[model samples]
Target: MLRATSLSIVLLALCACGSRAPAPQAAGVAAPDARGPTANAGNHAFQAAITADDFAAHVQALASDGFAGRGPGGIGEDRTIEYIKAQFARIGLQPGNGGDWFQTVPMVETTADESAVLGLKVGQTVQQLTFGDDMVVGTRTGQARVSLQDSPLVFVGYGVDAPERDWNDYAGIDVRGKTVVMLVNDPGFHSGDARLFDGERMTWYGRWAYKFEEAARKGAAAALIIHDTAGASYGWDVVRNSWSGPQYDLPAKDDPAPRLPVQGWISGEAADALFKAAGQDLAKLRAAAGRRGFRAVPLEASASLQLASRSVEKHSRNVLGLLPGSDAPDEAIVYMAHWDHLGTHEGGTGDAVYNGAVDNATGVAGILEIAEALRAAPKPPKRSVLFLAVTLEESGLLGSKYYVAHPVIPLAQTVAVINLDAMAPVGKAHDITVVGKGSSQLEDLLKVAADRQKRRLVEESHPAAGYYFRSDHFNFAKAGVPALYIGSGSDLVEGGIAAGEAASRDYNEHRYHKPGDQYDPTTWKLEGIVQDLEAVRSIGETLASSGQWPNWREGSPFRAARDAMRAASVGSR
Candidate 1:
């Protein structure tokens, strides 16, 4: 049976809706036996191999001030990578790719100077918008200076160019050397159902990164996204912090997205104001962005931003370990977690380390634990098992993006990817939430393990978050590999769904991506962490042993990609 501790989550969620502070957490007395279920036989062995106390200790060590928040290119990376390398060593797994465990990912770190202005012109008015308040801009451009003053601006609905859905926002508009402004979330977000773009499932089209790339491919000088709390999954402050930090991008060899001269976000308030200035109603424009053949509307406004940035090119490693399979070591099952976090911004708020305890320290720890468990098992997996601790996941999933572009093992032989990002804290829940549930058959295996634990398969409670595209697994998914990204369920101990939701809501506001996310023994529980980690690990191990390479669920967008890969594999061989 399944059992979880169900600890309270300290998520510092900043309700992106600009709503008031979340309703108060109702004080409820403790319930008997917070654990939900007990592991039986095989699961019991797996559970014993991983425990809550152990998880806490590892997370505490990683999230502690010592790691300095584990940001990339910082001193924290030194300690974090060593720790991961040591963990793989302790687990007794062989170096995954070639001889060395380190897959050197070349990265360029860029930090934009704050005092710059986007010399924007709308008709007779030449307004210079400030960096943090009105806008947040940065570039992947290798150039020293990028100027986009007279570059025409166009509103390209969701900025999606999907032919299958018969929707192209860029139709009849040549965005070359222009700036394309688009909405944040998918069309279904505002229109609900009966509209295109995955209804409300948040296809890749809605992602801000996709907007920039699509605009860039269309030869746009810049791309801007109108940020709303609900659509972006966080507040403008979140946007500011995420944008302001030192950004890492995979080197050009990593197929670096064609850098737009300026890629930035405008606050919802600023966007509304800009809308008014351009004679386009924000509400009406949002509605228009959802329909088919949405045309790009010229804002008749021009944005010119000069970003002065300090560029540093450094190399970070994606730690990889291999367990060669029995029959076909050529084929493999992959398990992954990102090793990077916001890191120490240094003197900022006296928090030098972004220990990323919950943000992902738990996931890295989970990978280490899984590695140990698999190493101890008497029978090796039938296909190889690749354990990867990727770098720069916090920075637009650059590490995984690099790996897929230049795979140590062929992407064709790579059967599936299991990703751990921000696992459930030390609490026991009655269910698990698989983020992109319908994408692959891995969820079925997860279901088997969850059933063994007596837990239910919970549908994602917040699909609008676009969490599927937010993590490292998306990089693999985009390259035709089926991926599993499971998140902790929102079912609490004494509170059921309400209690769990309260903790989740709290953490998102107060702790998410902040220094306040340090490990706490008193307020947190690692029971759930161990439980879910065990669940994901069990699935990976099972897949590695099974001859079947798993399948995407019917009607899954990833299914076509998977099927195409299968055909290509057969034809090539």
Candidate 2:
């Protein structure tokens, strides 16, 4: 990340149409007696204090090769945590986690041996599936060796058990000690009928994480997700790259949720061949699964796999810095970004470093730039602002989930959580995209802020991808806290929607989760990131100064948790 020297320079060079002035500052720290400022004062200072160069400088440092992709429990983790801590100190922020800058997150790293092959038996024919090319498998049970021999394979469509939706794919089927083969997303996603499981919008049920969880709940010995590019959003290469490395998760004891002995994904070709051997057509079966009242079907096959893995217990650090509220010190607003990435590849070809520049380095840099702006403001926020950089987001948001369970501040006192992930370096846009829109009341506050910048708030364009549940903010949402996750819109102010879409497509296909995602100062346009940071700052400032507590909207899955928490608080008082 590089910091722009002057707003005037940015306006002249980056913003061809028009630009706003960077925030003004007095430079020195505020007096001890100085009270927190009103929303308007903090908003004004934040507008001028945030600059393009500062954002770039932070991203450049975090995404640098010296950090080694910011892998957890390695040299990269040590350097990444220290860098964030130093930035917090330089910004004059206090420790957020009870006078400590670090919170230790316990995790278990499991690295599977790739030489192993999966056995799929159909009638008299048995096929061996290659590791990376045909399939990928790993065990979350934390065992050194796991085996599923001659386990009956059953095709469970979508593998969702949502009682509220009155749909149960596992109804009347006993999958104990069996292997479940399921689709990537939910039923309605493929059909595009809103009446069928929320239509195009992906519920939590559609996510791969949920699919595995549901399979385990039904006592399945193992689970395998059939890969479909349109359904999964990314190609099979993404699945291969993500699952091939050492996978990290909260220790088995730490998470009491049921887990299958083996969880994996198979390539489309492999799935098609298996289905053909079972005397069924994969495409036709997928179509039938989308409709209501679909039952689980036995595939007339068995799956056998022996997963050999080395499991080690390790500790990862979550870096936190606090700007304590002058009035309501205990109540807070949180800004989060994940500092961990794919790290360096151990046994691979070509480029080894999976430098997650746009994936998260930009997000970490963006939050650091915002923290600096908040520190430089004339007055502090009435409610504390916590700048949290978590670990293991790529590993199922484990760091954030741990923080939610063991919060630095009580969830009830926490006002809101704003998460920034993968802010594209594309230039200014006509609007901002709010992932998981219409889930909570925080969007109302975001709308007001976006309107002030003459920008509109648009729902995420790819709902089937379930981008909302894919980020750290989802942990907060699941725990009853209203959270907002937004990114630079794909409708560029200069080139319009087509240009913005092209950049998005290019990143997702060519650079995302790959070694090509390196920091290139030559081509990056940070003016748009600056714009996004300004809007994010305004939203946080408004919530920090106000007394209102935002909640999930009616009918939201999280609404009940918020209501129950409120009722319990009242009963205690």
Candidate 3:
């Protein structure tokens, strides 16, 4: 259950690459590359052909200068689109986008001026938090001016409203016309008990985005999350840089909910200061927020913010390719990976490009490799396979949202989605993390494959980060398609814990969404990546072969949708 830093994980990779391989293998056995299959004593020749070198070439090309860091809607996306389309073509994957390889995702890019000021009021202290340094705020509302005044802030612990679980943070209070400041994750996180809210595996309700939405649903004018290193999973620098750039999001015309007038995060220190000013102890308030009938506490701090906004209509593309099944071409299996990063951060590093070598180039390459393997398989699958390289994932899961809305195949027939994001190119680890573990039956299929590889299955270390909802896969999950967005674990097979933890920590500080995240052949090992990819491919194979369609667990929100679809299909038959 212990979690390692990103750097430690990377170091684990480095040490593993330097070390020797496990157990003897016969000659000509292929080692796992970035593709899904691993090398052992008797790997098929087809498996060996798609070796580590194949993985390396794809990643290097995707991260290279020609792609310009693959920023969505930029020249970068153009190059990325062409490159992926070509790879799908080479693998004999026909276009999935209604005979087209590209799916248009229209986005509204907004830039709030750096000069924007958030005037904060606590007691008599009037603190002005600058936009980029102290905090960053953006409004998805298509408006020229954004404003919130005399909005009383409330600490609504987690801002979760689940009637099914008998938990409501706003049980006794009316948050309408007020601002609700909340914690980042679910309560079970601090409790560590599996009885509450899927324990460490984040539910959609635990996501900060959901918190903001719930606040808006409760008629609150604004929402803010208290930032903690453990809770949010990223540092303030990540927040600053990620939000500071041009923000990409789908047009709001499709959404029916009212937008939060002001949404942002308050640093831990700043949040503590505010709690003290309101004569309420921060720890006590946090504790109370986790209770079953927690009431929103009035911090009585009003806020006034003025941001200069600029907007543009930008279009990104989702590369879609299909491998029709031998028996059931209409039913599809989707493999999705985000193909965009922060692009070139001006003047941030000596090298401007945030190449995102491991953040997602590795993920995109995995898809290409898997597509080739599926193409080379002895017989086509009964269900078709969809290889998707979506855009604006770093910004949001926008490209995927667009695809689901305009899917070439009906959403009901889409069997499953296996999302590979930020695959670790480090050494082989002892575990593979299934992030949204209990959402569907996919976890069992993965466990079977991982066990065969002598690897353990681990839950996500930072579930409060809402990693399930954070990536492109969330779009599919929300659309009633069973989804999997697993991660490469930080437990090293050879070098052990210290080395694994170090690699993860280093990545957060040095490479994550930064210029230094370029292709690092000297440091990375594709062994772990191959293990994860194969696990995904195995799951896809499982779904393709099984006549029975898997559904979400009994209590899942998606269960009703799946049932309804199944009933209609039965009626038609």
Which predicted model would earn the best TM-score? 2
| Candidate 1, lDDT over the whole model | 0.73
Sort by TM-score, top down from the best: 2, 1, 3
**Highest lDDT against the true fold, candidate:** 2
Off by over 4 Å in 3: 4-49, 191-196, 199-201, 347-349, 555-557
Q: Write the per-residue lDDT of candidate 2 for residues 1-573, one digit (tens) a residue.
A: 011111111111111000011111112311111222121112222233778766766776677656667778876777778878977886889988897999999998888888989999998789899999999999888899999899999999999998888999998899999999999888998877789887877788988888888899899999999998878766788788777767888887777777888999999999999999999998888988898888999999999888899878988999999999999998899999988887776544566666677868888888888898887788889999999999988777889989998999988888889998888787887788777778889889888878888888887666776677777888998989889888777678777877776676566667777678888989888888888888999888887788888898998889898888877766887
User: What lDDT score is found at residue 535 in candidate 2?
Assistant: 90
Lowest lDDT 10-residue stretch of candidate 3:
15-24
lDDT by candidate, in order shown: 0.73, 0.79, 0.72
Candidate 3 lDDT, tens digit per residue, 1-573?
245533322221121000011111212322223222121111322242346767887888777755567776666666678878877876788998887989888888776677888777887787777776676777777576888776777888888989888888888899888878888778777556577787765677776667878888899877878877666656666666666757766787745546776677777777787777777798887766655556777776877777667777867788999999888888988998888776665533266666677767888888988888778877789899989998877765667878888888877888888887777776888887776567688777888999999987776655555666677777877778888777677778767767677677667667766668788789879877777777788888778876758888877777787778767766876
Q: How well does candidate 3 score on lDDT at residue 312?
A: 78
| Residue lDDT tens for model 1, 441-472 | 88888999889888887667666767677788
Worst 10 residues of 2 by lDDT: 14-23
Total backbone collisions, model 1: 36
